[model samples]
Each structure stands twice: as C-alpha cells, then as structure tokens.
Target chain A: MDLLRFITAGSVDDGKSTLIGRLLYDSKSILADQLAALEKQSKNKEDGEIDLALLTDGLRAEREQGITIDVAYKYFSTPRRKFIIADAPGHIQYTRNMVTGASNASLIIILVDARNGVVEQTRRHSIIASLLNIPHVVVAINKMDLVDYSQDRYNNIVIDYAEIARTLGLKDVTYLPISALKGDNIVEKSTSIPWYEGPALLELLETVQLEKDIDLERGRLGVQYVIRPQSNDLDLHDYRGYAGKIASGIYRKGDKITVLPAGLTSRIKTIEVGGKEVDEAFAPQSVVVQLEDDIDISRGDLLVNGDHLPQVEQEFEVLLCWMDTKTLAAGNKYLVQLGSRTVRGLVKEIEYKVDVNTLERQPAPAQVGLNDIVKATIRTATPLPFDRYTDLSVGGGVILIDETSYVTVGACMVQ
Target chain B: MSKEHNYQLDYLDQLESEAIHILREVAGQFERPALLFSGGKDSITLVHLALKAFRPGKFPFPLVHIDTGHNFPEALDFRDALADSIGEKLIVRKVEDTIQKRQLTEPGGKFASRNALQTFTLLDTIEEFGFDACIGGARRDEEKARAKERIFSVRDEFGGWDPKRQRPELWNIYNGRIRKGENVRAFPISNWTELDIWNYIRREKIDLPSIYFSHDREVIDFEGQWVAVSPFIRLDATDVVETRRVRYRTVGDMTCTAAVESSASGIDDIIREITATRTSERGETRIDDKVSEAAMEDRKKNGYF
Candidate 1:
C-alpha cells in the first residue's frame, strides 16, 4: 500500500469535522477507548449526540470556543492505501494555517454545504487550492440528507463550482454528494443517491492516479549533508558522499551530473538508498551519491543531471504569502531558504495582491499584512538554482525567515 | 536504467524516506543536537533509523537518556548494551540527581510517578550541554495534542511550548533558526502510527528488550488496568499481587507504564494483537495520561516530552 496526503477546507458550519469523523468512524479507525471518551464528552454538550467534531478539536481553547485554530493532522488507512489528513480551520483570519496545511497535500477536499450552493468561502478555498497547485480536487457537496438527497441541488452546486474551477484553472476536479451526519457516500456508496454514479469518497482517495504527479525527467537533489567516514578501516579512507533527497527524477550510477551555482561537473560513482547501495534512485528517496571527481561540495549546493539544469540567477519573481504579524513592505530584508540553501534576500517590489475570493489582481498595496498573497520580486545575495513552483514544487518552494526574530514569515512559490 | 521503471514506494519506504530527510535536516541545521533515547520501542526504532541516516559516518549527535530512576532494569540494561554495540556516545543524566540537587518535593500517592520530574532533568541537561535541538520520537498519532504540533517544535528558554505562538511550517522546508538560549524539539517520525512502527520494526528485523514479549510477572490490578509490582509503587492492604502473562505496549517509568495481559512472544504475534486490540496505546498502558482530559496538553505546555 502507498500513502496519500490530503487536506479538507471549508467553513466552520460546513461539517468538515463531522465528515472527517465519519470517515474515521466508518473505516473503524476510531478505537473503543477513544469512542468511550467521545461518548462521555458528548454527554456534557447540549446536543449530546456523540459530536464527532470533538475528535478533531484538540486544543482546550478550541474546544471551549467551538472553533479550530491551528492545523490538526489525522491518520487512517485501508487495505489499498494509508492517508494523512491535514484538518485546517476555515476562517478568513486562519488562511495561513490552511496554506501551511496545503503546502504538502497531494489532494484537497473542498466541502460545500448543499443548503448554500456556492459562496465566497468556497471560492476562496478553490483559489487557495489552485494557488498551491494541489494535484487533485474533490468538491464534496455535504449535508445531502438535510436536503433530502436532492440530485438537482447537487447538480446545481457542481455547475457553480465548475465555473470557479475553470476560472482558477484547477485540474483533476471530482464532484460527490454526501451527508456526513448520516454516514452517506463516505466509505461506502450511498444507496440514497442512485442517480450519482461515482465511486465513494474513500474509493476515489484510494485509487487516485498519483504516479503521474511525480516529475521523472528533471532530477534535482539539494545536498543537505556530506557523509565522510575517515576511519582506520581499509575501505573507509577517502569516502565522500553527498547526502540528500531526490527532489525529482532519477539518478543512476555513472550518470553525468552537475553541482549547481558553482557549475562543477562530475559523474555519479555510486548511489545508496537507506545505506544499501543501489544502481539507481528516484525522487523522494533519500540517498547518498559519490562522485568520480573530487569536488568541493557542501550543504546548500544543488546537484542535478547536466542535461536538465535549473535556472541559475540572482533574482526571480515569486508569489509570496505573508504569514507574519508584521507587514511585509518593499526593501524588507529576510533569509530566503530554498531547499537546503539559505541566503540573504531583499523584496525588490510588490506588483499586486490577488483577491482570494475573486481571482482579480488588485493594485499594489503599500504594505502586505498577514495572510495576504502578493506577487513580488526578490533578489538574493548569491545566485541559486531553482525551478518554477508550477513545474517542480520541491525545488521551487521557499520560506522567508525573519532575520532578527528567527521566525518563518513568508512562503514564496518561485515564478 | 529503464525509463519506464515503476517509481512508487511502499508506505513504509515513504515513511522511512521522510524520516531520513528530517534526520538529515537536524544534522545539517543544528550546531549541537542530541537524540532522546528511552530504550522503548519508539526510541529504539529511532536509533535504527539514525543508523540508516548516518551510516558510513559517525552520527553527528549523541544518544542522550534522561534516567528517571524508576525505570525497569531490563530496559536500562538494553539501553546500555545497544549504545555499546553501536559504538556511539551515550550521555545519561539522572532525575534522582536533579531531585536531590534542586530539593524538589515528590508527589505523594499510591503510584507516585516520576514522569513529570523527567522534564526538570531534561531541561537541565539541555542547559548543561547547550543543545540547540533535541530529536525525539514523538508521533502525532499517539495523542491529540501531539497531532497539532509541528515537525520542528520550538520552545522558549524555559522549555515552555506555546500553542498559539507556533510558526507555520510549510512544505518540507523547516525553519530551525532559533534565538540564543532557545531550543527546538525535532520529531523525525511524527507521522508514523503504532502499527506502522511495528511493521517497520518487523521488516527491518530490529532487536528489542525481552520485556516486549510475554513473560510471567507480578502485577496488581488498579482501576481495570494491570500495574507491575515494583518497588516504586506503594502496596495497600487490599491490593492483591498475582502472576500473569503480560507484555508492554509502551515502555516508560515502571511506576506509571502498565502492562497488558498477552501471550504474544514474537513481533508477528504482537502486530496481530495490536491489530485486534480495541483500546489505544496510551489508553491501555499509560497511567499518567488518565489524570485529566488535557493531561498530555498540559504536560506539553510545561515542557514534558
């Protein structure tokens, strides 16, 4: 079985927690002791109907206020695959949390209440999903039982979302109708919605084609550490291995490679994955590579196949998401970290901010506040090798860190 | 190499790769780091992963253990033996020494657990060594509060965790940058579940202490749980101690970590039993977590691992 990481985005009243709870409940992932605790807590509430939302509200303040503040991760597995759910809060102020959750998700489930067909919150979530370039999208029209499982309502909502998807250029979009409160169309097919001919939510999650999502032609590896064992043994005198995770594509023994920024050339002498020597290694695999030529390589240096070298420049454009409380302005200096490299960077200019609700580009703002997405130009102190975020997320995504406070302040997708 | 080769990794492989990446980050970012080892299955699995992560070269960080003095003898022996066999540095700091040196009052109860006192010794060790990061084996699947924590959790000078002030972690890029006197608690295996750990251990053929397997031991019944009859706990007049075949699901201070009645003698049997069990790992074994609803959360806020 493989693993799939996903995120669920919706408003507080859209039954996002209930849907997650139902999926875990129907899949038998909730154990007896946990259920007993939930039952006991449910009794203290007014509804007293085994509030599944209690399972995801982890923080004490969240439980008291009946709102999710930060991103909470949930896990469940089936015979075919295992899943990691990033249950992020759905509030205008909490967009940073959603962006943080969506940064690593392979798929996204945007919940739309059947009673309210299409709203600004739905549009905002779709825009964020589009901005993050999530590989798959599932528009779950929830609360169908409350609407008497009306096929027409589902169709209308799907039609509305299709227009938004087209505007945002979302790919691999899927639609489904379900009632989380009544456990319909979650783990198993809902007999009530016979007109909707699609696999259940769990089935789609299990069988989603994720193999094609990986870019195998452009291999990239950022050297995080160098493994050198200068031991007294006969075979360990002069071993220098560049250690890193294959960001994309594959590396084989004897393959011609280049160390970026420095522009040094070398041939792959050997590849080892998990300490076991292998002939070839692919993306997402943490491996150690030895070069035939002795080169000065260290952390923050990029290694790639010579044929598919990334852009090497000192300045680039990025879509920056402000996550810090302090406003982001032009000429602000911060540490820009891409892959394993950290360099001093300056925000040269802010072109405009994208209205998350409507995909329109607003005029350049004097200052960018928290949760604002803006297109900006950044100039690094040193040249770096990177790919466009739309092409290779692992190599292109960068985080801006506050130099004095030592906090991550912004997330930038290299343009 | 063929261009059409299948590139999909197994679930365990993916988890392993992710963990290795995190470990390498710790090695690359922190100036002074240490791996928190407790000789439990989780920490043991972490040691195994560290081997895979830094083999052919010495581990950049040492294996550090916070000895609670209430630990089982079997686990302590195993911890020393494993460290010795691997030829790694092991630094041990005792909570007993901290309690005596600091003149702290111990909790009074039938099961007087030193689990909370562990934080004091751990913080003291961090200060003593000037460690900028502590790599732990905490998994999000173990508790609700842990589920909300980030892979690179930052703590103040007092070792306090403020949930509201947590920085947003995006993508695989972790910000290990911290001010002086502040340290980060990095969890490499934050996403693995209990069953996943067992499956990985079985596939990797890792060795464990004999206490993980079924054995005859003297245990006392306490609130529908089985507590081992060790010198750390007080025996009452009504308390009856009996011999029962049991195995531990989690390994902690013997005064607090309970045992479950089981006859599973091998990893396969243990995996099968865990698959069929209804109770959660901490719910079945950890007596300390039963104190209140936000037990783990409160402990984490005050700097408990």
Candidate 2:
C-alpha cells in the first residue's frame, strides 16, 4: 500500500479535531476501548455528549485548556492508503509547529470553517505550506453543517482561498465542502448536497497521485558510517563500505559519483543490504554502497551522482521562521545543520519581513522576534552543498542553533 | 556486480532507512554509545535497525536494559535469545539490585509500581558505562511530553531533562555534544507511531515475546488498567481475578504494565487492533503515566525514558 503524510491546520473552533475524530470513527478505524474511554470522559464533560475534539487532544493540559500546544499525530487507513496526519496547532504562536508538521508531508489539508470563509490563520498556514513546498493542498471548507450545507458558503471559501493560493504559487489545489462533526463529504459523498460534484475527502486522499512529491533523480546520499569486518583472512580483509540512507535520487553499479566536503570522485562498485549485494539503490533506501576508490569518506559527507551537483556556497538567503523568544539580530552566530553537516553561521542581513494577511513584504525591522517571518542572508563558516529551497526541499532547509544553549532557535527555508 | 535485487520496498523500509541513518550518526558522533533494549517491540525494532546499520560485523556498541526486575519472564528470555543470536553484548541492570544495595528505595504496597524507579538504574548504568549517547525506541506519538522532545534530546549532568533548554534537532545532522556527566538520549523511532511499530514488526517478521500475542493469563481490572496476576501483585479484598485471553500493548514493569483482553493471537491481529484503537497504546498500558498530567514530562525531566 502507498503511504501519504498530510498535515491538518485550522483555528481552534474550525472543527479540525472533529474532522479527524469523524474520519477515524466513520471508517471503523477506532478501537472499542478508545471509544469507550472517550465516551466515559465525554459523559463527565459539561456537554454530556461525546466531545469528538477529545480524540486528538491527547494531553490533559490540552483537554483542560481546550487548545493544542504541540503537534499531535493521528494514524488511520483505508484499503488503498495509510495516512499519518499531523494535527498541528492553528494559533499564530504555534506557527512553528505547523512548519514542523508540514516539513515532511506530501500534502496539506487546510480546514476553513465555511461560516468564517477564509480567515487569517488559513492564509498563514497556506503560505507556510507553499513555502515548505507541500506538493498538494486540499482546502476543506469545513462546518458545512453549520451553514446548512449551503453551496454558496462553500463556493465563497473556494473563491477567497483561490486568490491566496495564486499569490502563494501553490499548485494542485482542491476544494471540498466537509462537515467533520456530522460526517458529510468526509468519508463518503454527501447525499444532502446535490449540487456538489467532487469526490469525497477520503476518496481524494486515496487517489491523489504523489509521483512527483519527492525527488528521485538527484541520487543524493549522505554517508552515515563506514563498515569494516575485522578478520585477517585474505578474502575478507579490507572490505569497507560506506553505509547511509539515500536522501534523494538513485544509484547503480558503475554510476559516477562524487563525495561532498572532500569532493573526491569514484564509481559505485556494489550496493549491499544485509550482506547481500544488489546492483542498485535509490532514495530513502538503507543500503551500503562500495566505491571503486578507497576515498576518505566518513560521516557528515554527502555522496551524489557526479553529473548533477547541488549549489556549493557559503552564503544564501532564507525565509526564516524565528521560533525562540529571543530576537534574531545581525552578527549573531548559530549552528546551521543541513543534511549531515553542521557549520557555524552568522546572520549577515535581514532582507524583509512577510505580512501573512495581505500577502505583502515589509522592510526588515531591527530584530525578528518570536513568530516573526523574515527573509535573511546568513554566511556559513564553511561551504555547504545545498539547493535552493524552491529547487530541493530536502537540501535547502536549515535549523539555527544557539551556540551557548544549543537550542534550535529558528528554522530557515533557504532561497 | 550482481543483478539488481529489485526487491519491493514498503513504507517500513523507508522508516527503517531513516532510523539506520540516525543510528549511524550516533555511532560516529559520540565517543561512547549504548542501545537501550527493553526487549519490547519498539526497542527490538531499534536493535534490528542497528544491526542493519553496521552489517557484516558485530554491533559497535553494547545493548543495555534497565531491568525493573518485574518484566514478563518470556520477555527476558526473548531478550537474551536476541542478544545471543546477534552476537552482541547485553548489559542488564536491575532495580531490585539497586534496592537491595540501598542505592534506591522501592515503593511499598501491592499496587506500587517500579516504573519511576527504573530511571535511577538507567542513569547509573549510563554513568557506569560512560555512555554519552543512550539510543532508545521512544516515539513522540506515545505521549504528550514525548511529542515535544527533540529526537537528539540533551540531558544535564544530573540526567534531568529541561524542556526549555532542549537542543534544536533539524534535518538529519544531529549534534551529540555535552559537557562532562551530561548525556543525550537518542530516539531513532521518534517518528514511528503505535501502528507503525506493529506494522514494522509484521513486515520484518521479527520475533517477539509470547505475551504480545493473545494467551490465557490471570488478570485483575485495577483502576482501568489490566494488572496481571503475579507473585508481586497484591489482590485486594474487593479485587477479583480470573483467566482471560489478553495481550500487552506495551511491555513495561510487571507492576505497571497492563494487558488488554483480546483474542488477537498473531501479529496481524495486533496490527488490526492497533489500527482501530482510539486510546493511545500508553493510555491503555501505562499505569505510571495515568497519575498526573505531567507524569511523563516529570519523569522525563528526571531522565526517565
């Protein structure tokens, strides 16, 4: 079965949690014991009915405070596909959580309450998803139940979101009217809305193609370890292979490759998985590849096919999301870890801050505080082999680390 | 070169690859490392990934189990069997030994659990072995506080976790650095959820303890958790026990681990149950965590995995 990772982003009252609860419940994906526990807890609540929001609100603090503080993951599957849904927080302060959730997802589902149309958080999440290059976006105009399943209400949200999607350069945007609370247009087609013609949310999730979501042609590999068996026997002596997961692309025997950092060149001699030799390996596969030359390859170095080289540079511009309370100032040094390599970097300049609501950019202020979005230039101590964030999602992102405390202060999408 | 293997790789294969990459980084970045094997499905999964990470040779580090001295007998046997099969060194440190040595105190009463007590033994073992990196099979989805933990989480010299001071783990280039007496707990399966663990166990065909499958065992319904009838358990006047077909969602201390009544006898059945369960695996199995809102966060702050 195919795997599809998607992120759900919405405001507190937009019924994001209810949608997930209904999806799991309607599909019979929920266990009896869990439902029993929820029912028991719901009985104690003021509503005296099963609060579907209690399903994704796993933390006691979240249930007590009625807010999601961190990203909560929910798993469910139909016959065609298995999904890992990142239930990210919709509050502006929790925007970092949204980025973290959508960072590895193939698709993003932005829930817009049909009654509210397109709100600010909706635009903010859509922008981040686009900035993160989430391949597909499904704007589920939720709470059609509140709007009496009105086609006009859903159409308004679609039109409002379309303008924002165009400004964000988002492709493959699909709109659907859904009622996560009452289970309309969620698992199966809604019989109440005769004017709608689109497939149900679950059906779209099952059939949406993800062939181009991930890069499979760059053939990039980051060496994680060098393995050598200790034996004096002549036949087995000096057997060394560099092992790692293919971060992107594919490789085969006799494929010309270059090792990064040292820039050494070699040809792939063999690829082995569990002592058995294979002729080829590709992205995300854990295999040990032996090279013809005994190059000085070690951890922290990347191996890529020789013909296609990522940009090697010391300075690059990034669309950064400042996560920590401390403000970002010029001349501040942070550890930038990209792929397997970590280098000291200095913030050289702040280009501008982004206005999430109006889809506009403003002049850079003196500092970028927590939850602030800005474009900045950072210079690394050593050159890094990277692709523009737009070109390669895997190679272009960097996490800023505070040197004194070693805390990840911010995340940057390299431009 | 041999002909292309052309083997069909599944989602588990991708997850395993990511884990192996993380494991190799730990091996390379740290001066001393150890794998925290609990003989449970998740930790065992980590061991399998480590074996594949450094194949054609023995493991680069020893496997350590912070034994609570209350584990299922079958799980302990399985742990030993796995170590022997892989030709890797196994280090077992028991909480009972710590209590007997007066290094730690045990909670009194039949309902008491040694779940929190394991932290002392784990920290002691890390110091005794001088291990800088302790790799575990903890997944973020298992608990709320864990969900906030960084994959390469840093612990202070006292083996306490300061959530506010956590290192930022971005991408796969994990930084494993610390001052003297400080250590890092590396969770390779941080992304894998409960269902992923079951699916991986099925896909790899890895052997697990018999208790994971349905079997007739004496159990008592205690405070919404299924307590197995054991010598350590204290049967209250009101508590009644009977034999039931049950399986463990999580393997923990005997005093704390709970079993669920189910007729699911195999991995496939367990996977199906896991898929359908709304309550978290820990919610049903972990008695220690049910005590408070910050139960996990509090324990993790004190260096418990």
* Residue-wise C-alpha lDDT for candidate 1, range A1-415, written one tens digit per residue: 9999999998669999999999999999999999998888874455556899999989999888888999999999999999999999989899999999999999999999999998999999998898888999999999999899999899989999999998888989999999988888999999999998999999999999999877889989999999998898878788998999998988999999989899989899999998999999998899999999999999999999748779998999999999999999999999999988999999999999989889799997999999999999999999979988988888889999999999999999999
Clashing pairs in 1: none
Runs of candidate 1 with Cα error greater than 4 angstroms are A43-48, B1-4
Top candidate by DockQ: 1
Q: What is the TM-score of chain A in candidate 2?
A: 0.96
lDDT (CA) for every model shown? 0.93, 0.82
Docking class of 1: high
lDDT of 2 by residue, A368-411 (tens): 89878899999999988888888888888888878876667888
The candidate that achieves the highest TM-score relative to the unseen native structure? 1
Question: Where does model 2 exceed 4 Å of error?
Answer: A43-48, A233-235, B1-9, B144-148, B161-182, B213-228, B235-249, B259-280, B283-294
Per-residue error for B283 in candidate 1, Å, reads 0.4
